[model samples]
Target: MSRARLSPALVVGAAISVVFVASALLSLVWTPYDVAAFDIGHRLEGPTAAHWLGRDHFGRDVASMILLGAGNALAVSLVAVLLGAGLGVPLGLLAAARRGLIDELVMRASDVAFAFPALILAILLTAVLGPGAINAVVAIGIFNVPVFARLTRGAALSLWTRDYVLAARMTGKGAARISLEHILPGLASVLIVQATLQFSLGVIAEAGLSYVGLGAQPPAASWGKMLADAQTLVSVAPLQAIFPGLAIVVTVLGLNLLGDGLRDRFDPRLDEER
Candidate 1:
């Protein structure tokens, strides 16, 4: 197998992703300053020895808030992705294993789900449950369900026709057994790549939801909420918006790069072209 696992994209992406995760985890124990601490007298102060990234309108340490925000964003996105995969994978396997009315129904249901974007779902949830990070997770997770289901079903369908799968069938192994033994493993590479892409989307969606007051309540650091708070003052305190905005951009960029690298490394077909 062509081993491009350590390609430039992978190295850079991994570096960025590692930083994102490390900084987030670090915030759990320590940050430069208390993000919630407000020094009204020092509000909007320029970057100094204490505040590396300057201060927000409330004089909260920008760096500290960004650090905490990373944790919040990561938690929401990670849980949402897990929730989606947990439910979608099984449904997809079942549909692929028995491609009749069940398959049609599963796919049709996914289509219906696709009709409602995460924004709509988040809004609906907010109306009933009020806005919060947990609600954002559910909304994002629901949106991701059809994505994994479709990908799994497509990959599984092809695997079902493979010689190994046919041999397993001939050996009288049940569909469930054959799938777990033969089909699921084959889907891992593609699924991992898709999961990475979906993760980036999840972060973006969470930010969008938070901006509209449909996610991450007050006192909880969130990049989108930071952006929302900074909007009116962008012309005067551009850094307020710049820091969080850059965080989102860089985070998403790293994830997309990682997904692309993983796709290249995992897809053997690309070897021939190279």
Candidate 2:
């Protein structure tokens, strides 16, 4: 691995990721005001002394809602990413370490899974489970499984041929034990890089789920839900859509850049090339 050091892209990406992550965390303890409390009297009012970002049609403070919604989006995305990584990484390692039938089956299954997009999967899940945040997570996570599995398998395969791994195999160690002891450690940098990229995609998937009434429900205050609510009212009050849209854009872009930075910093292949 290359030495850990800051680049311009890394600094900017980390800054954006931190700001949004802090905003999400802050909502757990506090917001500008009560997000659920309605003040119809102030509905659609422009930004004022009391309402910094103005109030929506429901009279809920836009800033407060955005803050709360940040929490929703982040939570959903983070969980989905973790779910994918947790399940997919192990499968990849097992396939790589144990090859033969296991490798064939895992790779074939991943190809099958790759066929369904997150939105399509979400719709299928919503049909059976009903639309909710959990369904959105499941949908996004299932889609991500193939992504992580393929990447992990490819990365892990290289590690399997390493001198340390070949030596481990000579000791008559079981595949699982060898994978855990020898190969898993070597795959961390690749997994971390992939996780960051998937996390950004998860954010978008969560938002899209919420937008279509498949994720967070009413009063849950997800960024996508806010956009859905404000779409029709854009002519009446454009800022309603603008703020949440910007939130999604900035978050996704930052995560992508962060993933890029990690790739540049962590990829030994890239280092060798450079």
Top lDDT hit: 1
TM-score of each: 0.96, 0.95
lDDT (10s digit) by residue, model 2, range 1-274: 3446666677788899999899999999999999779889888888999888999988999999989888988888899889998989998988887789998999999988777776777677776888888888888888888788888899888888889888988999888898888788888888998999888988888888888888899878898998998999999999989988999999999999999988888876777886
lDDT of 1 by residue, 21-61 (tens): 99889989999998778899998887899788999999999
Task: Report every candidate's CA lDDT.
Answer: 0.89, 0.86
Pairs of residues at least 3 apart in sequence or in different chains that clash in candidate 2: none
271 in model 2: Cα distance from truth in Å?
A: 2.7
Q: List ranges where model 2 is wrong by over 4 Å.
A: 1-4
**lDDT score of model 2?**
0.86
- Candidate 2 local Cα displacement, residue 154, angstroms: 1.1
